[model samples]
Target: MKRPNIVWISTHDINPDLGCYSGVWPGAEYAVTPHLDRLADDGARFDAAFASAPVCAPARSAIMTGCFPTAIGTMHMRTKAVPPPEVRLLPEYFRAAGYYTTNNVFTDFQVEIPPTVFDDCSPDAHWRNRPDADQPFFAAFHGMATHESQLYLGEEAFAAATAHVPAGARHDPAAAPVPPYYPDTAVFRDAIARYADLIAEMDHWVGGILAELEEDGLAEDTIVVFWSDHGRGMPRAKRWACEAGLREPLIVRWPGRIAPGTVVTDLVHTMDLAPTMLAAAGLPMPSHMHGVPLFDAEGTLAQAPNQYTYAGRDRMDEAEDTSRTVRDPRFRYIRNYHPDRSAMQHTQYPDHLATWSELRRLHSEEAKELAQGLRPDLLTPLQRSLVAASRPAEELYDLAADPHETRNLAGDPGHAADLARLRQTLQTWQGRYGDLGLRPEAEILEGWRPGGRAHTTAPPAVVRSPEGLAADCPTLGSSIAWTTDPPAEEQREPSPLERTAGIPVADGRRWHLYTGPVRADASAAWFRAFRLGFEPSPEVAVNIAQGVDDAQ
Candidate 1:
């Protein structure tokens, strides 16, 4: 069988509250989303699909490379480096396997704008209309219309839905399942309702794209994989290791190839998608990819005694912390690098913030007490004084017992054995991946620096002229003109990381710091990171720099 066209439809922060996942909406149960619903009815739906990281950048990195976020050092957002070149990304693999690859202008690889993931990554008709009609295609798309920045529509939709209630009606705390730690307030309900609206809108877009695929006669030849980068935009959703943050809706459809109406409850991670696609295409899986194909020709997953999935949260919003989690079918284990941080620390609790603001504005008499009681900045519902101090360093959760993960079981005596086993698994993974987890206190005490480089206090300056090999350096006062193309190397010497480093900064002003390597193409983030004196992630940087432009 020849390889089929692949269409990967990815969305931004969204939760599993759709009609398919949650029966809350009208007609959701009998919703006629012929494209997506048909896919689910025809192919397998993974109940346990999860993102490797809860945030966008790292999650995308893991999805693309079939490697954990930490494995590539792309833990944080825009600040962290991109993946080094040479390692084949999922799209690149498809491209090499004789497929025309396209991406719809969304590159969230923790770098600057203009993603560098593909050969034709433009948002124009170019990607929508692949010239290579004879070859099978791979088109990956992401939508930001439902993201936090575009949250107004959801808010408006929610207010309209609740218009029947009197403006001054008191909120019924009993109506909703109050988070053990939070006060059941109207604000919370409002937020959840608004989030649902956003999700509804997102689904509409998903349906639209799938509809277009069908209209263009691409659906039949395509294997449609729909998923989100992470969960929704709420506290404990986007930046945490909890199920709400990591678990994503995954629907895979490959007509006649995958079994119809199958639901895989086995533990699966984001990295697994890449190898699975390669296997489906009859292409040899790269040795570096850590994940396995999800199914065989018989349309069944490989049997195993236990399955493991992992997730990590490095940094998001304002708070920067490190955490890793391991989840089996039965339990979820968390290893927090900085346990002292608040469980909800960098997370933006929109409802809490808005409520705190409203109470102070409307009820001034009680405002002082409420403000005094609550940690104004912490966003926790509790008014405890001591709890605001710092977060703990480690935590464990009995996922079966507490699905919401409201209680921490790390300090419990009864769970010691379970904790130890999970810790061992974590250590084994760390060793296998050569993880550079937070350095030990002793190493820091001994004045250790990553990469063994000292912080230099010198501004960047070009010593060599734009043209290569001048006997003399440019005069200090002379102005250097910018050039479009940097000098091409007939035989470029590989950097330490086997990367090509030089790029034209301005006018033939070739600057080379250290970019890890060249991958699909170099991004602008590569230039900036290299300029910052750290090695640039060639693939990510290039993607960010060039964006989804077809020429890039």
Candidate 2:
């Protein structure tokens, strides 16, 4: 009846091209990662694991709470707010059940940790590390080095350490199944290579942690789970609901408890991890968790049930849009909530980065144009055709036939039934979670402001309008104008700026206004104005407009 010690290692922005997953990765096949591969060989490897959402905060939230991101309104990465404290968060559950809980600072939640949640907040420590030999522990370690922005050393390190790759074996653009959205070039190959290298580096980090657990003689008694917050960070990857963005590498290692070398291909989501951990700890599953425990009748681990895993995408990176996907073993279905918006609006690829001097040297001017065809700013004729012609509603892909999700099956007459079934599932889920599809016009800029400040203004009245003014605030005292530029359309009208002022009416109600500037002592004033439903105080307004506005 003793609870097992738990150690979970999570990496940010990793792809499923590791040595255990596939041999096609040039970097992983050549790089050294003896420890991770050994663990996989001796444990379970999940071939069908997926993240509920492809962004960091939402995905982590789902895993931590065993609830769908949509249910809690944290479907977007860092966009939506975090869950309220009343919810039974996974860590608090373990702590309540007599286990020490600790985290190595992965604070991607929308709100700061409340003082009641954890026993410690220091960088190198937490409650699990407290010198209490009698209690079991639940600990999490997050590795941010694998993040795409920080993978500067990845490419060079891969080239240096993976010299064993055959010279001609390097990825060839012509042979590769290049996604229609991206220009097939050495640049893409180099990007993937760099990504592979970062994954290998993460392998080393996981090995080090596992070795430490073993050194402490807790290896056999500990259940270790390795996963990524989401999929790879690339142009179309992070912000989309495609497999590249929504899928993740999930490996569960529980000695004696989980059968070894068992490959479970059934669909499973990140949320399941929380309930499974709780069940392993002998705690009753909370009714609030939407995920089912993946265990056998005798309380040992078992394969997950066969079902469709879901994922959603909302407002991340430079691109702002909404999308959702559902994938079973055979097929994947995607619903793009904003079909008018280009994928590039949600992401910016390195194709525009002038720092890659090799781009100029590798091709002629015409070739450069071809290479930059999918550039966010300049779409090639073919790119424009694809983007403009594609339907805004739905897409279906037979994943077995096209693992990369290249072709859309929704248009075919033969797939109508399949599409209908998936669409029904999607709609049922939306109703269950109360998804409004797109955010209301009034809420679009409700808490939004330029830079890192929250704006305060009267709650705007929203109305759909062909004039382009989607919202009108009472502060304006009348209907204002708003316009949306459609595809192949001209900017024939000015955008409506609903009237807002820094001052508020003497009434007790409060409003938020976008302050163009800020002054000293804005923090206290910000909360006060927010509470009063008035524009932020002059000090807060100045602080937000000009940033803290003074030396610390």
Candidate 3:
């Protein structure tokens, strides 16, 4: 059997809000994403796909390492966390398996990932740059097609992004549904409709990516996986530990392997993409990875009987919050460590959005009127709870009965048994993985960046030996990378793809993942070491005697 090429497409700040996911969740029916819908019809769409965290950096970190962010100390948003010493990203493993890896490229993993993990890693990187047609490839393309920034508070920005969409393709704000937490207003409805519009734009972008596969005549020989980092970029839906924040749309297209029109409802995390790729490539699953493969031996698209998926949230931007959640087939249980903080803790980042701005203004006006006795409890329970002084320590929601999670049944005696079961499950899961978020930020920060500053990894000492040139760094568990015949500078090309027809050779100057010594006799070799939460070490130049003799 021949190995198949792999193409991964990741979107930003999206959720199960496409036409293919219409029946999976509420408010999803409003999208007009024909490209993704057809892709799902041709391959498989997973209804229970989820992220390990609700934010981009943490969720992306989890997917990269095939481990939950909380377990690997990468749970906080926008903050780099040091992963375990043995952790190698999926691409590095793929490279070791003799696969030409590429990333075109978004590297917000919240951990230091060496550039050598991929042969080409830039906005223009592509599998077409590989050595030959026979060589298997792993190409990943990530972009902000439907990201939160697309909301476009400024009219000029909105017009520039949505100008491509036809009048019929645009969504109707009047028909948008309002969740219980968000007040029914024009602003909320417009935000929902705009999200659907962005989904349409994302579908167009996805079509272009898929067209590339078809254009290269590799669509039938490649496995394409599509998923988003997290959920929609809305108030209480993005950074919170709710169902909307964690659930995502996952579709896999494996020609001749997976059956068409298969809808998988079993729980699968975004982190599982790594193990599935390994299984597809006939590579051994790393013992430290926490994900379960989604494919059986016969390519039946069946999983290893997973009952629940988990997620965590911590230190979102300017606000400090911590929560862990466990979701079964039917219910969701969230345990908030800092119940003293309100669900809407005034995070400065989201406050700038149109939806968030409107929601805050309404909450403020209502609070002012209530405080002066102008209105008596006029706010709905769901709305009031979101703006409460403090959140409940525990929250339980039956997803089937309340898809929107508008009701919390934690204290209800009728649901106490299930709540207790899920709470215990979360505890056991956290303990088993040694949840690093359990420690206060102060203690954890001391280890990552002491004195609120990033440390630098020591330069690797490269020594010539009988085998080759071996490089070792004094910094514990630092990753090392090297390249020969390097490019003149580090800058992107004007085109989206920078491919050379010539085949790759031993001393091509392309970066290599430094697992051991370099046996290839090359001109000049540049080496660097990097670790998460630390500054990358300065480049160490080692000139071979055969070429330049400028060794340092």
- In terms of lDDT, model 3 sits at 0.82
RMSD of each: 10.9, 14.8, 4.7
Worst 10 residues of 1 by lDDT: 472-481
lDDT by residue (1-552, candidate 3, tens digit) is 688899998898888988888878787888898999999998999999999999888898889889988888888877657677667678988887778999887777775456657888766789989988789999999877678988755767876687667888899999986778888888889888888887788788889989999999999988999999998898778898888899999999998888889989999899998888888877889999999889843466655447889999898887888899999998999999999988888888787888877766777888788789887344577877776789999999999999989889999999999999999999999889988888887798887777888788898888888878888998875778887766565554423211211112223356777888787666678888876446778888887765323556
TM-score of each: 0.69, 0.70, 0.91
Give the alpha carbon lDDT tens digit for every residue of 1-552 in model 1.
767777888888865544564432121332223445666777777777789888777788778777776766556643334343334457755654557677776665542221122446545513357666767888888776446544434446645543433443323333433444433466555555445445555566777777887787776677888888887665566777777789887888887777788777777786788887887777888887777788654345655413778877876645667788888776678887876676555344443455334333333434465667853442343322112435546667786777666677888999888888888887788778755335432343234225555332122122223332112112221111111233344534434221211111112233322212222233332232221123322221122233423111
Q: What overall lDDT, based on C-alpha atoms, would model 2 receive against the true structure?
A: 0.60
> What lDDT score belongs to each candidate, Candidate 1 first?
0.57, 0.60, 0.82
- For model 2, residues 1-552, the per-residue Cα lDDT tens digits are 778888888889875656776642222353334566777777777777888888777788788778887766666645434243235457666765666667776656433333223333335643336668767888888877567664344457656543433454444333433455555566656566555555666777788788888777888888888888887766556656887787777888888877777666778887899888888877888777778787632346555464788888876644567888888778888998777776544134433432132233333354566676843434334334332423457889998877766778999999999899898888777777656325652353353333534444344333223432133344321111111211233323312211111111112222222122222223222311221122322222112233323211
All candidates in order of lDDT, best leading: 3, 2, 1
CA lDDT of 314 in candidate 3? 90
Error of 3 at 491 (Å): 11
Which pairs in model 3 have colliding backbones? 484-509
| lDDT, residue 239, model 1 | 77
- Among these predicted structures, which one has the highest TM-score? 3
